[model samples]
Target: MQQFYDFKINKIKNLSSEEKILRKKNLELFYLNGFPSKKDEDWKFTDLNFILGQNFTNIVNTELIPDEKPFNPINEFEHNFIYLVNGKLISKNFDHEEKDKILISNFDYKNEIILYRENTLNFLNNALAKDGFSLEISKNYKFKKPLVIYNYFSNSLKETIVNNKNLIILNENSELTLINFVDNNSKENFIINTIDDIKLKKNSSLKSIFINNSKNNAYFYKYLKNDLEKNSNLENYILSSGLKLNKFDIEVNHNAEYSSSNIFSALNLSNYEHQEIKTLINHNTPNCQSYQKIKNVLNNESKGVFQGKIFVKNIAQKTDAYQLSRALILDDKAEFNAKPELEIYADDVKCSHGSTSGSIDLESIHYLKSRGIPEKEAYQMLINGFLCEVLEKLNENNLKKFLLKKLESQIHGY
Candidate 1:
C-alpha cells in the first residue's frame, strides 16, 4: 500500500514550523490506517481501498498551477458564482446580492482546530489540503439568487490526489441557497477527498444542491457535517451522476428546539459506476424533525447504496423522524443495498424507516407503448417520472427545470 501513495508535507507552501509538525503527525496517522476497506463498519458496502487499488497504480500530492481558462457561467438562471480550478479559488462574483452581506476568503488553516480524528480521510485532508474557501452570511440577510461553486479539475491531475476543506456559516436570521456544481470534463483518472463544515445559527435557513455537468473518471468522497440551532432549517438535494465512483457521508445534529433537517437524493448509475449516500441524523433536543428519502436507478452492472440512521436522545421528547429508500433495477446485473437504523431513548418519539428495491414495471411500459409511444420513448418516460418525484418540493422554477434536464440526460446515458 505504501508503494501506491506518495505524500510530502513540504510540498505545500507558506506553512510555519509548528504547522508543518502538526501536518506530519496527521500524515503519519493516515499512513497507519491507509484507505478504508470493508472492515470498517461505516464503509462495509463500499470497499474504497480495493477499488482505488484496482484503478490507480501510483497517487501523489503535487503543487498545482492551473493555466488560464475561460469561465463559463450557467445560462439557465441568473446567479452569483465562485470559480475554483484544482480546488484553488480563482475568482468570485456576488453582483446579485448586497456585497456587504457576504464574506468570502481562503480557508484559514492556521487558526482552525482539528475536529475529527476517527476517519483516516480526515487525517489525509488535514495533512495535504492547501486550497479551499470559507464563506459567511451576515445576520438577517438573504440572497436574491443562488450562489454556485464551480469545481473544476485540471487535465494534469492524472494519477494524482487532491484534498481540501470548506467552511460555511450562516448567522442568526439569515437565509441562503447554495449549489455545488462539478464541471470536470477531463477523462484522466484522479481522486478527490473533501470535508465541509456548515454552521446554522438560530432562526436561519439554508438549501443546498449538488450536481455534475458531464461524465468523468474521477473517484470522489465527501464528508459533510452540519450543526443546526434553535428554529433553524436545513435541506439537501443531491443529483450527482456521471462519475466512476462516489460516496457522500453526511451528519446532521439538531442541537436546539424546533429545528428541522431533511436529506433527499436521486441518482442514476449506468455502466460500471458505483454511488452511495450515508446519513446520520441526531435528534438531541426536544420537538425536532428529520426526514430522508433516497431513490436510485441502476443499469448495466451499476451499484447503489444507502445507509441512514436516526438517533433520538432521552431528553428529546416529541421527536419526529422518517426514512425511506427505493431502487429501480434496469438490468439483471444491477444491484442496490440499503441499511436503515433507529436508536431512540425517548418514549414519545415517532420514528419509522423502510426500504424497497425491484425491477421497473413491465406493465407500465407496455401500456405506454400501446398508446402509440415508441418502446424506447415509453421506457424513458417511465424512468423520468420515477426519479423526478424527488424534486417536487423545489420551488425555484428555472433551477428546477435545469436540474430536470440534467436528470433526463443521465437517464438516457448521454
Candidate 2:
C-alpha cells in the first residue's frame, strides 16, 4: 500500500500546476481519512472483507487499447458514443454532424469528492483515479438521439482495480439522455469502481439509464451524486445483472426550488448472485417533488436489497416525496430485504414510504395450472407478468423494447 501510494504521488508531478495541486489535496485527505468498516451503519448489511483481503497495491499492466472494440449492440442506436476500456477513455476524435454542440474533456481531480462519505472504497477510488472524463451538452441543444457511454473492463495482468470519474455539466434549457452501460471481459476477477458527479443548471433536464450486465466474479460499485437547480428534472433508471456481488449508491441533493426527480430500478437475479441498491433523495428547497420505486425478481438462492430514504429540510415547504420497494421471490431459498425511511422537518410536506415483498401466490399458480398450462410454464408466466408492471413505465418505445428483449432473454436462459 505504501509503495502504491508513493508511486501515485510521484506520477502526478508531471501534470499541470492546477491539476497537480488538486491531486495533492485529494491524496492528503485519503491519507488522513482511510477506509470505512462495518461499524458504519450504511455498510452494516454489505460485506467488504473479501475486497479488503486482497492485495491491490501493485498495478502491473496498462491496457491502451481493448483486445476488440465493441460496436452498437442495437443497429438502431443513432446517438453519440464513448467507450472506456478498464476505466480509461479511448482517446479518439468522433466525427459527427453535431460535434459543435458537445464538449468532452478530461475530468479534473477533486479531493472533496472523497469526503462525501467515509466509505473506504470511495476513498481508494478517488486516490487512484488515473484517468476520467468530463462531458457537457450545450444550452438548448436537444438531440434526436441519446448518448451512450460504455464502461468496459478487461482482465488485468495482476489483480486489477480501476476507478473512473465522470463530471457531466448541463447548461440551462439543455436536455440529454444517457445510457451508462457497464460491460466486462470474462478472463479474471477484478474490482471496478466508478463515480459520477452531475450538475444540472437552471431549467436543464437529464434522463439517465444505468445498465450493468457484468460477467466473471468481479465486484461492481458505483457512486452517483447529482445536484439539481431550479426547474431542473432528473429521471433515472437502473438495470443490473450477472455479477458475483453488485452494489449501487445513488445520492441526489436538491437545494433549489421547483426541481423534481423520478428514480426507478428493476433488477433480475438468479443463482447465488447478491445485489443491493441504496439511495438518498434530499429536498432542501420548497415546492419540490421526488418519487422512487424499486422492484426485483429473485430466483434460486439469489438475494436482493433496497434501502431508500427521503429527507426534507425545515425550509422545504410543499415538498411531495414518496418511496416504495417491492420484490417477487421465486424460490424458497431466494431472499429480499427492504428498508424505506423518510425524514421531514416541515409540517406542510407530503411524504410517505412503504416496502412489500412476497412470493408468487399459490392460488394464482393453481388457477393457471387448471387452465391447461404446465407448472413450469405457469410459474414463468406469473413471474413475467409480475415484472411487466415496472417495465411498462418506460416512455421510450425503442428502449422499452430493447430492455424487454433483454429481460426475456435472461428469463429464458435461466
Which one is best on TM-score?
1
- Return the lDDT, model 1, position 255: 99
Model 2 root mean square deviation, Cα atoms: 3.6
Per-residue alpha-carbon lDDT of candidate 2 for residues 1-414, written as tens digits (9 for 90 to 100):
233323254443346565566555666675564444356667666655433344355442233344446544545545567777776677433344377878887666543343344365665565566667888888887756777777766655245556668889898899888887766656565666778888998899898987765444666788889899999999888777677667888888887999998888777788777788989999989999998988888999888988888999999999999898989887899888887888889999999988889878899989999999999899878777766666676788887777676556556552
Q: Name the Cα RMSD for model 1.
A: 1.1
Candidate 2 regions off by >4 Å?
Answer: 1-35, 50-72, 91-97, 110-118
Candidate 1 residue lDDT tens string, 257-320? 9999989898999988999999999999999999999999999998999989899999999999
Which residue pairs overlap in candidate 1's backbone?
Answer: none
Error of 2 at 378 (Å): 2.7
- What lDDT score is found at residue 249 in candidate 1? 90
Against the unseen true structure, what C-alpha lDDT does each candidate score?
0.91, 0.73
